[model samples]
Target: MAVHVAAIDFGTTYSGYAFSVSAPETDLKDVEILSNQIWNSGTAEVASLKTPTCLLLSKDRKISAFGYEAEEQYADIVLDGDTEDYYFFHRFKMNLHNNKNITMTMVLEDVRGQPLPAIDVFSLSIKALKDHLKSTVEIKNIKLDDRKTKWVLTVPAIWTDTAKQFMRKSAEKAGIPRDRLTIALEPESASIYCQTFPSAGCRDIVEIESRYMVVDLGGGTIDVTVHEKIPNGTLKEVTKASGMVVAGLRLMMHLSNFSFAYLADHF
Candidate 1:
């Protein structure tokens, strides 16, 4: 029997998935790279990549939307409300860890002035991604029954144990099995891909006896790590790493506000 493995990069602003097929004679040479592209626009000049997150609502007071479409639709509706009973937001991953002044509201009400919990919002997003995986691939429906499909989910290294537990719970609420899920640090995963580059001639080798910092400036956070290279070419952690979630996109938003204010005065 062949095995299907799925890897999910569950990012803050964007998320993605890659799958592999296990078969006989499936060595590194036999592995095929799958194209992740989903949409194209413009005069055959613009191509948009797909991300595994969305906002959606069903007719029966349920939300629905996923991937790039969900993201675009969420933005469109948030800025220009045309749809009723559907409220969505992208880049919600950052808000998951934030506890200060964060508020979320749903359209449906049950006589109480309360909206859905944050975990519910996250579950809806996960469901959209799960639906996409089912529709895009040719896996047997029995696979769903067998519950053999496993997932590797990525998270920022700076996340606390509490945050990590919440993410696990959210995934469970989205129908992903607890035993099938494995969590990996985002920067560490990126480093794995980065380490392959020196062998590919993409970057020159740097030989240093002392420890060095690996600073990852991502869309939602800034991660810093200090690693020591051993004599056998293996990397070891010399000190504890740190990160700040209030970087990257937040900084850009601040700059944009300044630019808009200056432009308004000039115009």
Candidate 2:
């Protein structure tokens, strides 16, 4: 049986999945990203390769929408002034990063100030993504089977053991078996992606044997890594992964607030 490689980036502000059918060693160019790329960014519609990491749940805790659909539906609910009943969560992945002692019993606060079990919040989000990913695999003529596929899940490198374990269990609850899933560090993955497609603009500075730094600014966390190119076109980390784990999201929020304030003052 042939095994296909699939990766799910359950990010803080967005989440999406991609699969590669070709062998990484032999056929490296047959990777495909999903075309379901349009999203409603609250004010306007936008196209993106990934969906917003937002989830809308009914009063009874059943998921009503996810990703872009969740964003639009939640916005409509807010406009209708009935936002108190529905639990809408956006950028909630940071909760794990903030808490060092995460557990199944820990409570998570939704955007509406309502609380739910952290496990329920994370697991439901993962399940939603996994189901959508399964549909995409079927569309690509690859039947879903745990044994015949390898799953790669991305997580921030600075997350604690408790946080990582929570994500692992959430994946298991989302129908991804322990044997088929592997957790990858987000910064390392980004480094690999960059190396796979080095920018022509920086080729002169990033030539063979050159050392460069990677500053990964994710939705919830920021990480920096220094890599040295090897003779075989591979990169090795020369410095320890370092950076503030909770800086990117906070910085983005501040920037957005500043932009709004600037517009308000001018108008």
Candidate 3:
């Protein structure tokens, strides 16, 4: 039996973790899910529930920083003319989706176009988040026993089995035991999260036989899924998850290009 349930949302643009203590006596509705503290981008006044999916590695192929701090340090490194000795990566999650020939030894290109093993990049990034979560829980006087904790990792539903396996391998390399880790679909996770709110004001809307559609507008793609609540208090997918490649990041790029064109014409 698990004593804690922790979930890591490893998103394309941002990432974060949340957890709840497992108690058989407590009703599911009463379980409190606590998320990590807000992350601030050191370069600006920006803050969010999740940090940027960025990472920096030293010349020796060791992780140097992650999230917003990674961005800040990479910028400083460039300004100092030491960029050749460092690697900066951001928005690399989509590589898994776009590449159909993913392999255990495939390499990922950094911001500088330098290549590094994909496993190293992913495993290090996950390790950073996992370590932070453990520290956060420890601060609350909770000792996380590896045997009693179940870890959940969310990925896009459209991902191929090869990609999912890659993630699992990366998680294992990051120190999460294979038996204790579970992979969850992003749309499904979102649907369940929505059920936690009160029905009168957005919670408890998902009752037995209730059916709904979940559209996830993520940084990498837009995914749609239909789910029905079963008598077993679990959700069943009515249709296969379908998604388009165009989503948040694509929209932003289009808007940025349009803005640039307009400025160039005016100036």
Candidate 4:
């Protein structure tokens, strides 16, 4: 019997999940990415399979919303002059990448400087994605069963053991069964997805045993990994992953500021 597999990419900038009824490895083309994945469904300002990793919480520390819904609800909260009574966080995943010494007591501050436990924020984010994924899977007429469903959660290849463990714990907290979960390196996941579809751009490349690099430019951090194609068509990490914690969103902010300054100086 074919098994179902789901992957939750808790990305720094965007978070989303993809599920396939049949095993991804059994038939590469069996994977079907869900459409209209998140909030602001028709707005041209925001269109994508995933939403920003932003989240909104109640004063009592409960998750009020997430993604574009979170953004919109937080804006409403601010307009009502209740920003202080709620927590709104955006692109906070970079905190883990930026802090090499992340501790249980470490806290993350919201846009209004409201503080909450980092683990709480992460678990809330993961929970949001997990709940949404379950809803979508059910909509596909597939009964959401842990026994039939296996999950792969991706993480940066260069993350420390502590960070990796934290993510595993967060996923467990989100209600994913420990036996159904697998921690996959981000680069390896990307490579596997790419390999599923044979591309003309890669047809001319040297055959098997070729080593290639995977460079991921995410919203919160950049990661690069080197992998070698093995005899079994599987990829093996050949070199240590390299990257930094600088936010990809920062580049857009800097460019926007520079453009505004130049326009003001000229006109």
Candidate 5:
């Protein structure tokens, strides 16, 4: 009996939310998905569907800002000579996977290498996105009843059950009811989305009986899934989901290391 479905994608490098409202009789392909596509980057000419994964905390540990606003706020804080007290975090989502021994008590370091409870950081970030989405729905004049809304959170398929549970706990701590939240695998979601394409646009690609692979090259992880379309218009996984940490962020780290090594050797 849900009136709308909202999905949050907490990416390593960026994060965003999307939602759709449709009648039960409406065609899946006809349902219009709306997302936060006007993320402000301070520069008037720069806007994107997702915002940078960043957070800024005040001296007392309260959330000051998030996303692009967090970056701009931290920059101003630095100029004001009060940067020491604030905590700024970016690209911290990878810590959940990088730490093989992740637990509820895990801690994550901020940009200054200062440690804070990982659960707190994650919950706060999720809360920010959740609040933003609520505000957007209100602005659109949509009557979104929290009790009647379905929330979906996406995670990398390669994540361990513990990591996935951690996300669930974080979402709950962020005020999302446990029963209302559904955890979805990134590549599987992609496959489902592909299924909605019209035959002419996706003929032989995702058509019935077609076999294909979905490679989700994300910021912190890369996931691959093979699927086969059944005659009933459903996709069945043909193989186990697998992935690695060698993705966009990791490549950037390698490039930075190479640059440093080159400078050390030449100068």
Candidate 6:
């Protein structure tokens, strides 16, 4: 019997899944990336690589929308409405490192009193993603009944122990089994993929030493790692990496501030 392995890259801005299939030779090969594996569909065969990290709360105090639909609706509400019931926050992953000190509140007219915890909001999104994955993939027969499908989730290298623990807890609450879960540094995972390309080769003939700084500029954070390349083509970490949660999205928000002010004054 062939063994089936599933690898899930649960990113902040995007998430992806790749499966490993064992052949008759007992060798495993990674299959192509799966698409539309995370949400319901109403359109053509277009694939969704990344779902927005935003969630929409309905007047009934439930998760009314998610992913791109939530993103669109939230944008419309923020840009063109006077109603304050709807709550939306993009780049939610950046907020993970804020620890438990900061409390995010929502004062919806429908729901009385204080707002929901940031962690709860995050948990809801994580749960939605997990549910989506379970429905799309068939894993019952491949694995033993007692053993659940395993997943490898990627996180930033600079994530504190507390933050990582929080993420793991969130995953548990989202229905991901603790026994089957593994966490890999996001930059390391990206490096593994990048090293596969031939263009990343060095030029020296006899002895060559190369160092690369992998800068990951994502929607929520910017992480950079320095890797030392050895003769055998394997990279070793030399220096500690550094990252900032503030990124491109912050710049866009700054620009939007001015644009929104101008529009308000003119219109």
lDDT by residue (1-267, candidate 5, tens digit) is 435988999999899999988887788889899987589788545788999889898878788999999988876766666666888888878888888998999888775566889999999999899889989988988876666788999999999899999999999998888999999999989878877754565557566789888899998999998899998878889999998896667777556535533433343
Worst 10 residues of 2 by lDDT: 28-37
Q: Candidate 5, which ten residues in sequence have the lowest lDDT sum?
A: 257-266
lDDT of candidate 2 over 1-267, digit per residue (tens): 454777888998888887766545554434543433344565565777789888899999999999988978876776666766788777878888877778879998775468898888888998888778788768768787766678888998878878888999988877788999899988888777766655876664346788888788887888888888888877778998887766657777556545533433343
Q: After best superposition, candidate 4 residue 253: deviation in angstroms?
A: 8.3
lDDT of each: 0.59, 0.77, 0.84, 0.75, 0.84, 0.59
TM-score of each: 0.70, 0.81, 0.88, 0.85, 0.89, 0.68
Candidate 1 lDDT, tens digit per residue, 1-267? 666656666666566676656675576435543424364333334455556344555435376566666645544544453344464444567665554443333222211112456777776776666656655565433243226876666778887766677677778888888998877777666655554444554243234444556787767887888766567766677767698876668766456435533433343
Every model's Cα RMSD, please? 6.6, 5.1, 4.6, 5.3, 4.3, 6.0
- CA displacement after TM-score superposition, residue 41 of candidate 6 (Å): 10
Most accurate candidate by TM-score: 5
**TM-score result, candidate 3:** 0.88
Candidate 3: tens digits of C-alpha lDDT, residues 1-267: 436987898988899999888677777778888998788886798989999888889989888999999988876776667777888778788889889899999999775568999999999999889888898999998777755788999999989999999999999899898999999989988888787654564544467888888899988878898988899988889999999786667677456435533433343
Model 4 Cα lDDT, one tens digit per residue, 222-266: 789877877887777888898876644767645643553343334
Residue 80 in model 4: lDDT: 64
Off by over 4 Å in 6: 1-17, 21-48, 59-61, 73-87, 98-114, 138-147, 196-210, 229-235, 251-267
Clashing pairs in 2: none
List the pairs of residues colliding in candidate 6. 106-115
Roughly what TM-score does model 1 have, to 2 decimal places? 0.70
TM-score of 6: 0.68
3 versus 6: better lDDT goes to = 3
After superposition, the stretches of candidate 1 with alpha carbons farther than 4 Å from their true spots are: 24-35, 39-46, 52-54, 58-61, 71-83, 100-114, 139-146, 195-213, 228-235, 246-248, 251-267
